[model samples]
Target: MLCLYNFIRTTGTLKKQPVYVWMWFTGFIFFLITYLESYLWLIPYFRNNIVNDLTIQWKSYGSMVGSWNMLIYGCGIYLMDKISGTQTYSYSKTGFAIYFLGLFNLMFNWGHHIYTVPTHGYIKHVSYLVSMTELLLLGRIIFLWRRQMKQNKKHIHQPGFRFYAAADFWIFLTLVLAIAMSIPAINVYTHGTHITVAHTMGATIGINTFLLLAVVFDQLNPLIRKIKNFHRYLLPGFRICNISLFIFWISLIVAGIMKAWWQVHRPEVPFSTMMISLRPYFMMFMITGVTLTAGMWMMLLPVVKQYFMHGMHAKKRMELLYKKRNASLSTY
Candidate 1:
C-alpha cells in the first residue's frame, strides 16, 4: 500500500528524497520476507525439530530484527535532517556513510547476537569488528553536536531538541554498553542476563523512542505555540521522565551485572534465592516504571487536548476560507 502510494503520489519526488524512499522501500521488503518466513517456515519447522533447529532460528531471528531496523534507522536519518533544519545532512558524505554503515550492520551484526551459540570463532570476530565501526560514526556525531551545543545554548530548551539530545546521550551510553557486551568474554556471562535486556531497552526506549518523540514534538511545534504556557507543563514531565529513565537504566545494568555474577560464581544457588537477591532491583524497576508512566501521561495529555483544539480551529478556518473563495469566484 505504501509503495503504491509512493509510486502514485511521489513519482517525481523520489530524486529529492532518495535516501528516505530507498530505506522505506528496502525496510518494507525485509519486513515482508521476515514475516513470511517466520509464519510459513521457521515456526513450524522449529516445532517439528526442536533440538537441532535452535541455532538456525536464532540467526533467523537476528535477521528478522535487522529488517525492522531499516525502518527505525531510516526514521533516525529523517529525524536528524529535520532537527538540524538542513537539507544537506541527508545528502552529505557523512549521511551516506552513516546510512551504508547502518545497512551493513543490519545485514551482518545478527551474528553478534548469537555469539554464545557455539558458532565459528570467525563469525563472532567479524560481527565484533562490524559492531565497533558503528562507534566511530557515533563518536563523530557526538563531538560535532557537543561543539554546536556549546556555541548556541538556546535550542536546548526546545522539547524536540531535548528529546533528540536525550537520544544522543542514549546513543553514547548504549554504544558503550553494547561494545562491552559484544566482547566474547563478556558475552559468556551476560548473554542471557538482564544486561541484554538493558541493551534492548536502551535501543528501543532510549534511542528510537526519543527520536520518534522528537519528531512528534517537532511536528506539533505550531500547535504548541498556539497554546498558552504549554512549556511550563511539559518541561517538568520531560525532566522527571528523563531523570527517572537514567536512574532506571542504571538499575537495570546493576541488576544484570549482579545476576550474571551470581549465576556464574554460585551455580549452586537456588533460582528462588537469586530472585530474592534481585528483589531490590526489581522494586526499583517498578518505581521507575510508575514514574515513566506518570511523566508520559502528564506530557501527552495537554498535547493531545491542544492538538484536537487546534485541529478543529484549522478545519473551521479552512471551511470559511473556502466559502469566501467560492463567493469571490462566483463574482468573477
Candidate 2:
C-alpha cells in the first residue's frame, strides 16, 4: 500500500526513485509475505511439531522482528527527507551504506538473539560481530546528521525535529546497550535477564515509536500552526511526554540490571526476594507510564478533534456546492 501510494504520487516508476526507496520497497513486500507465513504456516507448524530445539524458533522470531524494522527505517528515511527539504539526501553514499548495513542486519544479525540456544559457537560470534557493526554505522549517521542540524540551529527545536533528535539519542543509547549485551562473555550473564528486556524496550519505545510519532506530529505541524495557541499546548506536551518516557525507559534499565545481578551473582536468593527488591522500579515504571499516557492524550486530543471536524465540514461544504451546481444545470 505504501509503495502504491508513492507510485501514484510520483511522476514515474518506483525504480526511478533513489536506492533507499528500492531497499524499503523490497522490505515492505517481504514484510507482507513474512506476516502471512507467520500467521498461516509458522505458528501452526511450531504448535504441531514436537521440536526439542528452539534455535530455529528464536532465530526466526528475531529475524521476523528485523523484518518489521524495514518499515520503521523507511519511515525514518521519509521523515529525514521531509525535514531536511532534500530529495536526494537518502541517495547519498553514506545513506546507501547505512541502508545496506540495515538490510544486512535485517537478514543476518538476528543470530545474536539465539546465543543462548545450543547453536554453533561460530554462529554466535559472527552474529556478535555483525550486531556491533550496526552501532558504528548508526553512530556515523547520527554524527553527520547532528552536524547538519547544528549548522541550521534555527529549526533544531521545532516539534518534529525535536522528536527526530530524541529518536537519534535513543538509537545511540540502545546501540550502546546492545553492543555491551552482544559480547558473548557479557551475554552469558545478560541473556534472558532484565538487561535483554531493556534492549528490546529501548529499541521499540526509544527508536521505532519515537520516529513514527515524529512523523505524525510533523505531518500535523502545518495544520497546528494555523490554529491559535496550539503551540502553547504542543510544546509543553512534547516536553512532558518525552521527560516521562525517559524516566520510564531508565527505570526499566535499572530494574533489568538489578534482576540480572541478583540472578547471576546471588543465585541463592529467592525469586520472591528479588521481586521485592525490584518493587520500586516497577512502581516507577507504572507512574511514568501513566504520566506519559496522560501527556500524550492531552497533547493529541484537540488536534485529533480538529482534524476530524475539519474533514467532515469540508465534505459537507463540497456536497452542498455539488447540489447547487446540479440544480443550476437542471434549470439551464
Per-residue lDDT of 1-332 in model 2, one digit per residue for the tens? 77646744662567557765766666766666645544433465555653323655555667677767777777877888877778776778777777788777876687777776766777777787898897776568566886856844866655677667777778778888888887878877777766777688778877887788788878888666666777677778777887888888788888888877887799999999999999999999899989888877767887788788779999999999999999999997
lDDT of each: 0.76, 0.75
Indicate which candidate wins on TM-score: 2
State each model's C-alpha RMSD to the native: 3.6, 3.1
lDDT of 1 by residue, 1-332 (tens): 57646654755555666475567666776666656655543456556764335545555666677767677667767766666677686777777677678778766676667776665777778888988887886678677986767634757756677777778778888889887887878988887888888888888888888878887888888787777888777888888888878878888888899889988899899888998888999899889988987887777888899989888998999999999999999997
The reply for model 1, stretches above 4 Å from the true place, is 1-18, 40-52, 151-154, 311-332
Candidate 2 steric clashes? 0
Superposed Cα deviation of residue 117, candidate 2 (Å): 0.9
Q: After superposition, how far is residue 325 of candidate 1 from its true place, in Å?
A: 14
Best by lDDT: 1
Worst 10 residues of 1 by lDDT: 50-59
Cα error, candidate 1, residue 220 (Å): 1.7
